[model samples]
Target: MPGMGFGIRIEGLSKRYGEGDTAVDALKDVNMTVAPGEVVGLIGPSGSGKSTLLKCLGAVIEPTAGKMTVGDEVIFDNGWKITDLRALRRDRIGFVFQAPYLIPFLDVTDNVALLPMLAGRSNGDSRKRAKELLEALDVGHRAQAQPSQLSGGEQQRVAIARALANQPPVILADEPTAPLDSERALAVVRILNDMARQFQTAIIVVTHDEKIIPTFKRIYHIRDGKTYEEAGQALH
Candidate 1:
């Protein structure tokens, strides 16, 4: 099983752009941990270093100094220990953006299966896995539909399935429910919680949407490039 260790861990993580007087500190000694099978919320105002933190965790950018561990592997210590960040991301981390960003030309099934295929799985096995995920997400009916043909909720569900396609230990979701109505937004969170438990995937949802804030069992609030944790209503 993947994610055998703690899902994701960061200690003294900091990111700075530029130098000297012009230097901007986007993150300051940030610390966080997400256990396997847990879903947590990351809430912050604009310019609170939320995006920077996400980039660091996603391996899109490097941190000036930090220690990070994904599952049992320590990927960063002062600097990156892994040479192939792209492959690390592909095999270990799943991302769900605000938009579905599904391929326009590919049908829903292909869109979800693409990740596993890129990871070198056989095409047949990849499509089979995608179909199973679609069925789990209740979007199997739309497997043959194009992205443009699905409703906003359907597209997001497909996106979630794609993110889980690799069975990555962790999932990073950025404003995933921002475009949906309150009803749909909560439904999406419910689905995330279910997926997290089912796959033992640690999920961090970054959002400012007040509609679903109270649903999390724990919330991390970031401000002035720092983070603080608080208990949530745990509505789910």
Candidate 2:
């Protein structure tokens, strides 16, 4: 019901960390298409430009050259086609970081509601939407609980709920299950799959965790700023 067929599209994405002789080419000619409701893994060793690509795709940093499209909008073309990149990020993109990073003072519900509220939705409406997402993630029972009261898995679930609060077209996850055990790691992947299917969102998880690495049906391996795609072994 929320923005179906909302996949992420990237073409010729290249990033440079500096300029002139000191510049480092973080990403080189990175091109990828993530279909709606599809989940893929981006795996690489440290310093392979994974972070750079994520920054570019998430609009946290501009790419030196590339085109980026989210859902029905073209966000970047050579330079950004849209003004207000921050607003675009808030409205069109969702991010799940390695850590849950929920606020200590705010309860789970408030944390999730914060996104919609920031985007001009009413506080009540935002909280309502947040509650719905919490229920969907099976964390509604802990809505009133503070971050400190929840387990690691529960907090991660809340983080995921927060990410989906806006129902963004694309969700970028950076080591989403890094802090969990094998059981919890697999659970997070399953949750990601369910969320992608339910919301028809494109998800890219950047991770080095071996536990969940094999679960991905498609994997992108990056080395020295270049990428090669591989079809993973069957999950069944």
Candidate 3:
């Protein structure tokens, strides 16, 4: 499906919390598209529906109304199209959070290999995939290290490797650079861009970090439950 040039396609996406007069419309008729190998930015002020939109896209919360196509699969249309959301999330979507959140008990290789292993891949193959991703991300040297043994940047790189282990067509990065300094933050964004192109996966980074905003070639700004698409810098 990824080879067919599918990415993430959303149309009329909306989310409402509660009902009646007290209902809060978190997202209002939002439409956005990201192509394979593209790295796009999603930015907004605090409480501007960014988190709500992310949750919907990530399948963490059900949207009141919307249509969503991930890769070539129509996961949501007014309601869910797929029955196993847990499998869908685990297999089709990858996530990178503000913190690395690597398993403390696992080594770097096992940390990444865990995702593929959970997907039913053989242990040998999973670790092989993990090593490939780690090498691509330049964290191969720390493959045997524990999570706590790595630096902040190294740990985040491992997290990213883990996210890619399943070879998902889409990656949702939620403030991935929030914990880093200016230099490290920009470096992480660069890695995301390179990896997106390398693996032909679409990436949407939701962040408020000023240091990484200008790095995006395209940006979507959310405000008042609505979205406004804005062009950012040209591809670097």
Clashing pairs in 3: none
Q: In candidate 2, what are the lDDT values of residues 1-236, reduced to their tens digit? A: 12344498788889988889999999999988788888899999999999989998888888999888888788999999998988887878888989999989999999999999999999999999999999998999999999999999999999988888888988999999999999998898999989988988899999999988888888899899988899886363
**What's the lDDT of the predicted structure labeled candidate 2?**
0.89
**Candidate 1 local Cα displacement, residue 22, angstroms:** 0.3
TM-score for model 3?
Answer: 0.97
Please rank every candidate by TM-score, starting with the best: 1, 3, 2
Instruction: List lDDT for all candidates, in order.
Output: 0.95, 0.89, 0.91
Per-candidate TM-score against the hidden true structure: 0.97, 0.95, 0.97
Residue ranges of candidate 1 with Cα displaced over 4 Å: 1-5
Worst-scoring 10-residue span by lDDT in model 2: 1-10
Q: Which residues of candidate 3, in runs, are more than 4 Å off?
A: 1-4
Better of 1 and 3 by TM-score: 1
lDDT of 1 by residue, 136-181 (tens): 9999999999999999999999999999999999999999999999
| Candidate 2 deviation (Cα RMSD) | 2.2
Model 1: per-residue Cα lDDT at residue 185? 96
